[model samples]
Target: MANFTLKVTRLGFSLLQSVSPRIAGKAAFRLFCMTPSSAPKGEKAKVAHAAGIAKLAGAERFTLALQGGGKAYAYRLNGGAIGRRARYLVTHGWGSSSVYMADIIETLAATGAEVIAVDFPGHGGAKGRALHMGMAVKAIAAAERRFGAFDAAIGHSFGGAALMVAAAGMLPSVPVVLPEKLVLIGSPSEMHWLFKDFGKMIGLRRAAQQALEKEVHRITGRRLEEFDASAAAGVIKRPVMIVHAEDDKEVSADHARRYAAAGESVQLHWANGFGHRRIVAAPPVLETITEFLTGDDSVREAEIVPLFDLPARRMSL
Candidate 1:
């Protein structure tokens, strides 16, 4: 069934690419940015896992309406400690809701720090079927407004890219207070790579791919090169921990290397066999993330091991 869906999607893209570059670009934009109305595979198990975490952590649900339109859903877990610990903000990847990040949120809250997990526009119970990086930045800003400043942030995949965009001050309308510590998991460092990959998958020519990038620049006011997360990591002056699975078929491990290479404060942890989605729920990865968020500056540097050096392990998302 999944293979059939993939073949159909590829065929549709190939047909669009054969049209004009502009047509292909428009279609790609919609397909990449919009969330489908139907739930993804394993959605039920994901939802159940998240619900269990929320219940265990005593999380409170809330909603924030954006200025332009659309609503963002969030779950807040208050700290149990006597005095306030640092506040942490967590967000899931594209096509996923905050529920998928419940385990991480619950763990952070267990450490006596208040935590908030947000579902971007068009995700979870949020209003809209389309979501862009701009909308995601605005949603994060809205969460901050509702629940004070966050000292640390943890993001997976596209959500991590959104954090970099927010920190770069690209979303001018929605001012963001960049968190002191950041953890990016299975994130793509360069936006152009994603565009190119999509183009190749859709059988688009180089010209058509360029057209798609141009469309992205027209909408976001930033070129594909300008939106690179590695560049953002270089200038952000904050401690960063990049966690990438060597087996992550979605985003390459080179992204982690790029971010870590950008600055001395950036640390890269090479994980094995977690693939893309499963990495988020891995216990060891979770432990490392929590320690980095609470630990001292020493945690900012680590050795990067090759994918072959790590042992293989099977885990479900």
Candidate 2:
């Protein structure tokens, strides 16, 4: 992890040399669009995405690709229009689009609940130089407009972080009538840690990491230290469900604990085999998430170490 941080740190101003100023401004933007896939990004992502696409049927189709949250770009996957009660709002992580969350959307739809999954700004179809708290809510509102309102909220990685922020943080708070139950998958309890870790994975050094922090402060207008998910977790009044894989190589299971520690209302579930993406589709996970959406709190606490039956490597830049 230290080495990864060093790489990103190494990339600081000197790394910027490889790209133009126009590109550096957009580098973070491009990074956000990369999504979380185990395969090599770029061509491999396109291929893997094709496989994910091939699996879709019925209302599971990822359609209406467009910019959302008033950002430069965003994508929306409709789980076939809104139903009367308890809609499901799905959001994806950094560099990802609405496509990957299709299974969860479909599973939610199968339950007769409306599902609207959106790709946040700087990812998928959403357009923005970068993702901000303001834009995240915009994507949430965009889904609400069409799907009526979500009774539950689900997100992965960065999306998971955004889910908490959208539910508890953000301006105006999007009217309480939207999503009441929140689900975060593989997202850290602290934003600063998340960014710091992300920088490490991409080869950032301490100094470079500081530069990254500076950039974060400059762009988002908030101190990186202040963006603590645990603090944010405190403000969320509704039930927050946290799901993490024991074998997850990226975000550690400790992150899940952080969320649970933040508030009494938070619930943590440690899954056995399903990694980050597949967890959203696993029937057992689906059962757990669906139950949570229905306001069931049957999940019991267990040793988080058991989750890592298989050790996986962390994210590679």
Candidate 3:
């Protein structure tokens, strides 16, 4: 059914491209930003279970009023310590909700740090059918304002890119101050790559693609290329850990390399076996992330290592 729907969508866009490429491009861009109604792969049950994991871990579930008209669902997990510890923010990828990051949030909480996980608008418990980077940035800002400033943050895929863009204070709608430490897992280097990839997937023509870019510019008040995570990392003088799997089919490893090259304090950690989605929950990846956030910063940024003790060659920039 999905394949058939995709085919029909492609045909409709193709016809629209023939008549008015600008209209087709605008339509295609909207399709690109559409959020999933249910969890990815139709794992609605699993997502539900993950959502309850936070509550089971004694997290205080709350809803944050966003700057816009929507509200974001968030889970605040207290650290296992008595006094105040480092606070952390965890965000999930596109087509996913904050429930998916429940494990990571719990793990951070166990480390005696307050952990807050927020679902972007149009995802998780948030009500909407559309979402964009600007919406995500505002969600993060709203979360920060409701809760307190976080000492560190971790994000996967689209969430990571949004975190970077927000931290860089690029978007005018939500001027945000993100955590000093960040970990981006399987995230794209630039928004332009995502725009191009979506266009290719939908079989958009050149004119449609140009129109899509123009529409994005009109919405964000900046070119799509301007929303580069590498550029965000370059300007922020904070420690950033870029974790990517060599075999990740969704996002290329080159994005991780670009981040490492652009940021002076950025470290790249390669993982094996764990693909784009699984890397968020991979034990080694989580362990390395914990170490980066809580442990001493003794690891050298130049020398890259495999997060797992697999028989993989060391990757370097």
Best candidate (score: lDDT): 3
TM-score of each: 0.85, 0.72, 0.89
State the displacement of the C-alpha of residue 225, model 3, in Å, after optimal TM-score superposition: 0.9
**What lDDT score goes with residue 183 in model 3?**
91
Query: Which of the two candidates, 2 or 3, achieves a greater lDDT against the reference?
Result: 3
Candidate 3: regions farther than 4 A off: 39-57, 79-83, 301-317
lDDT: worst 10-residue window of model 2: 60-69
Tell me the deviation in Å of residue 293 in model 2: 1.4
> Looking at candidate 2, what is the lDDT of residue 207?
57
Candidate with better TM-score, 1 vs 3: 3
Model 3 clash pairs are none
How much is 106 displaced in model 1, in angstroms?
A: 0.7
Estimate the overall C-alpha local distance difference test score of candidate 1: 0.77
lDDT of 1 at 233: 88
Candidate 3, residue 119: the lDDT equals 84
Model 2 whole-model lDDT (C-alpha atoms): 0.61
